[model samples]
Target chain A: MIDLYPTRGGDEPRFIDRQDPVVYGTAEDGPIDAGTLAGFDRDGFLTIERLIEPEEVERYRAEMRRLGRDMRGDERVVTEKGSDEVRSIFEVHRVSEVFAELVRDPRVAGRARQILGSEVYVHQSRVNYKPGFRGRDFYWHSDFETWHAEDGMPRMRAVSISIALTENHATNGGLMIMPGSHRTFVSCPGETPPDHYKHSLKDQEIGVPDEDSLTALAGKHGIELFTGPAGSATMFDCNCMHGSNGNITPFPRSNVFIVFNSVENACAEPFAAPSRRPEFIASRDFTPVL
Target chain B: MIDLYPTRGGDEPRFIDRQDPVVYGTAEDGPIDAGTLAGFDRDGFLTIERLIEPEEVERYRAEMRRLGRDMRGDERVVTEKGSDEVRSIFEVHRVSEVFAELVRDPRVAGRARQILGSEVYVHQSRVNYKPGFRGRDFYWHSDFETWHAEDGMPRMRAVSISIALTENHATNGGLMIMPGSHRTFVSCPGETPPDHYKHSLKDQEIGVPDEDSLTALAGKHGIELFTGPAGSATMFDCNCMHGSNGNITPFPRSNVFIVFNSVENACAEPFAAPSRRPEFIASRDFTPVL
Candidate 1:
């Protein structure tokens, strides 16, 4: 299994050789292969080296930035800037073919299918761009709060993918993940009463650490920051605890996040409420595939 | 809003007012108007009196018993006689014309549409039969877990409907609900670990409550215990806390449950990954209707 954390000094990210192409051809074979999937089942998240060609990553980044600039003028974009500390171009998946192409990419889809085992569908998609020195880091939280309200057996969707269009380094403030945090289901404050649920990790308790300190803690428990060049991507279970620091680099940190789910796991309606756009409603259908 | 709990102790179980055809009609001034949706939302759950005629309910009950008997010999049916305390026949919506008619019932469908505010689709249908003296009571819990996951927000589906095929009363274990429970989210313990995502009523601890105590709690919180003769139906929010007590009477308690979700909020997959179903796959454009 790919060790989630490498030795302290060797913290620099290294690329692993791609596995042989399977029934569904994609670089996903490296991260979601039999071995990787088994590891993810136990570990909750996995990062693949060079899942996309470096050039392809560069192209996606350039195209996304252009789309983001164009969307700024579109009236449909509802900017919730300070709330999340990041500027997002909402509903780009509906208007931009580039965004649609990334979501429908066969490589990503194949990995999702293999992981979920059931027919899956696109629940939603978004593009987030973090301008350097412009925002506070996002709070650490799980993504399943709105969807799974009824308590029963645990259900999981495949890891949501965040493709780094820009090099995510210490200066650019890449994503940091808590290893084994998926096992810690922290009740979201305010969303539900604290007495009703228990939270293992609190936003106030997560102290920001330098690269050296991060590597040290990560080495001890296999926790690590997802810092790599522009072409790399990180795939994490939706339930895993993850958040990133603010970008302090010279350039803006941008990425395209495409979240997918298994078809058998139908989402609640309020979770996928339609955008105000008539076109979005015209094309979007909420029926479960299976 | 029709008050779920009338201060008067003798308020009889209200059946759908079929004689006032407007309430049951398709006209703008229908008896069961979608505008009544606001009332249903405030009340948490509502019963449409006489949703099915008494004769039809008898026929359905008889048919279910036959199906249960036939299943005793079928390998696919997993339980033995007497061992089958609570037998649920699945996918009746796809197999039974009666279910189809009920799903399309405008009086029911229109109200569901307004509450969910989306084009709704029948997610699944089942017949639950609780045999007299041999039936097991279900624990208090919410319904959202089976239909959706935690991540997808704004809940796609709004409510679930249980149509009574036999008289439901204290002796036969009618449904019991915790009022105002839907407003708050509680985490329950799951099979994997204590922290696994589970939702329940916050004010009450998890354990089986005696019938008298359970009924009293419902009454205290303005909760409602739905008791009625054959042909009545109760509709409740997916997140509401509810369950039934064992039948103490001589007769079996039987009901047909038809769950629907707004088509716009319908998901191709249920959210949250339970450890039991570890399989995950990427979603595809497999929604039957879209």
Candidate 2:
């Protein structure tokens, strides 16, 4: 049986210690990092804290945010309706030096290569800033919902890395996740009743009570809250149960969400959000920003 | 601006009417229907009510449940750790006539075709039976979290269809959806604090008023609960915000969720699920079950 972190309440939540810096430059010869890969296979989520230097984090955060704001204001960009409030910045690898550097970060990409077991490619990139007071709190959901097979392939693979610019904690509405929730794929919920809090589905229910119950259950199940200082990052399975509460902190909670996938698995289409034009791939000879 | 139906609290969500039924009669015409296509684009989801007959629903549900029970007994079919639940019954799709029929349902295929605007194929098929009080509730989240692209194509195209065999209602625990929530791709919230609910990312302090607060914000934005009669189903954009409440009812809330995509946009490799085998194809000619 795989060893897992004991649940706070009785639940067997999967947890792995953040990757150690000493192992950052470890040789990749035989058998991928067993511990990290096993943790990922079991928990469907893993974290490599301080994947990048503090200086690089600050640079990427500042420049990306600026670029994000600029793209959001561009009128030529036909923002999809209903998406006006939320900024959808794309293809930063081309425009931002910071992004370019980070995408090729050896530490990040190397680990990704080991885990993915394929030739990785930058599938898509974006920066989302949920501004305080006015920022939106994303509901609970998964990421695999949009992908479909085109060339007869059956499965899709993706890895998402989020770099926190601001400290992520309960006060700031850091992420709240359910342990081992990725094991199942649940159908999307439809509308809710007036007393939505009292609302329940055939399989489950959600409200203050349900939330509290799940929270308690999560604790009992060993689900852990991922809190970290700015520059620290966490990587979890795309199917993992994760979402953040509203950022109740005075400052904005900002993060750069970078998603990568095997080139064979990602689409060749241009970034769908800000632009319909395909993203440019650096020639094989060109050096990656990293 | 897109025309929207007049909505009332507790009333069934409205659907844009189509002059023609989205149907597929030929292989060359593609799979998804126009109505399904248009609905998915506008609402981020659509449903082909009664795509399968009642008898089919019953047949598939009973057989799959029996198979699942048998699998569980033999311990060959792995149940998600911590919970004695098997998420999707993909293998059943191979053996069950009902599942195979639904997977090849022209209505569904046609809609997927329209959204993807290309030839399409089935990515996976399974029975999602949220059993009695024991069933777990999936949190609000998006589908793109895990999907990756393939051979330069996007990871997904079109919508996911769930054909319900049993009545999905508040009593039985139907689906709860947040409309217009798909447009925003919010960052994954890491670990959250218990008191985080009291605070808003916009506001840093705890004890925020319940009125017009973030939780209330979702309500003001309003959530749509999908409660439909048996044989009715719903489909939505992969990015939409959705989650279900638990089965407070005594009976099992069951449905078959069949996912399809534009053949061009699916991942080169299927995401690692029980159904990830490359030979698994839901198309009629591709791999028809006797």
Candidate 3:
């Protein structure tokens, strides 16, 4: 492990890959423009205040609730509290039409292409159900690290879009991401921690940066919380360090995450050990999310 | 359902979407020309005689054989015989990196993009194994028809690359395609029949054209069997009418099939009832494969 916390610090940020076209488009509003693109390049993430409509969000939330009721299999549907409570539904797109449509929505896919300059495929799809009172904490970690070490992915060419299906505010433990941390490539060691696949009740640990190191990194880049009304969507680079706290508020935090990886940099299974997670969770089908 | 068989007997072909840039390149040969592009447009398919070298083909075949040894789950590993023989390994890309690389190869993806004029994602992947003694027949049908009705694929904007791993000739029951049938959009009916998933031992039927319909179609626009040495790769449009015969020869007919769909034309779950097939086999991840 490289202990990637930056020593030198400033509030001001440095941006790279400025020339690539970044789209500032939403589901309600069709086309994207140049200014939105620039902001994304500068921050390594973009926030669409209202990407999905409220009605659609309600419909999907109801669908998620229905799906959570019937979920079977090894470790797909997990929980912080035991006995049928929802935590996350792995690969929700396959089971629900609404989720599938969200993944293929041109509003999201168009921006992904603009940033990547290549065809894109969904690396993973999961619906995080952070129920009030018992919701658990997700320790700080970069997604690319786990993908590279465990799934045999060769590069950090993916982006994850977290769409809020419920109000996600600071009190409810919304996503907290380190600003501009995409520039700091962490050399994380170890395979996917065992608890990552199933429920995180016993252990909420997978490639978590040590506490002191995390404190230092947070001090340097600072942590930015993604809190918004339902339908708000945030697109973050795969390498951006992100985590969420345990939700104790009455408000539930539910979000659908769709991660897009560039086709040109598609991975081979690099790890010597086979993945414990099933195909649906860590997808092998690299078809571009149309 | 509209029975879309042609009316008259002729070898003449019709072309559509004439302006898109189609590639003439292959793995062995790097550059493509206008003449080759025109041929693909006219015939609705292309043939790359040696996409994989001999050594690579042998490695993949050995890997496939190894995979066949211990396949768990349902009809995914279909066979001509009972229990554990090789007929087709659905989603072979998921289990083996060699197969994944083969599907994502620039040699394949480049031509697909050239013809499609957009980003491409996989529709499906399978290793068709026509075993020596008990290989069965594949009835006449177009792939797009099934995809449109059963999988919610919106259009025929997809292509399949079939590469011969074994000697694909007449005796071994090679692929039989109706040239120019890409112009004939068939309205296929019925769900994926039982036994189409796990094995084909019981029923060899699904969306096959009736005898009169097949006779009229074949009579008007003759069927052509693909015959070539190992390593020969053929790319055909999704709507191209095709099927294969049963084999009794000692030499088996095995081929790797990769289907690519354009991202712009991706679809919702269009079918009335959901497909019974597994997600890995049919694929819901529309992420454009780079």
For candidate 2, write residues A115-197 as lDDT tens digits: 55555666556665655433434445444322211111113355677778776643344565566655543323232234221
lDDT of 3 at A6: 21
Once superposed on the true structure, which residue ranges of model 3 sit more than 4 Å away at CA?
Answer: A1-31, A72-74, A81-84, A189-196, A199-206, A271-276, B1-290
Q: Every model's DockQ, to 2 decimals?
A: 0.01, 0.01, 0.01
**Top DockQ model:** 2
- Give the Å shift of residue B253 in candidate 1: 0.8
DockQ-best of 2 and 3: 2
Q: What is the overall TM-score of model 2 with all chains considered together? A: 0.38
lDDT of 2 by residue, B52-166 (tens): 6777667767777887876664422334325766644554456576566666666666555555555756555667667643454444444432232101113334356777877
Q: Give candidates' CA RMSD values in order.
A: 26.3, 24.1, 26.9
Name the runs in model 1 displaced over 4 angstroms: A1-290, B1-31, B34-36, B73-82, B150-156, B191-222, B268-270, B274-290
lDDT for position B135 in model 1: 52
**Among these predicted structures, which one has the highest lDDT?**
3
lDDT of 1 by residue, A126-241 (tens): 66677653433444444543233222112445347787877775434466666654543333222222222111111222122223332333344443467677767777766665
Q: lDDT (CA) for every model shown?
A: 0.51, 0.48, 0.66
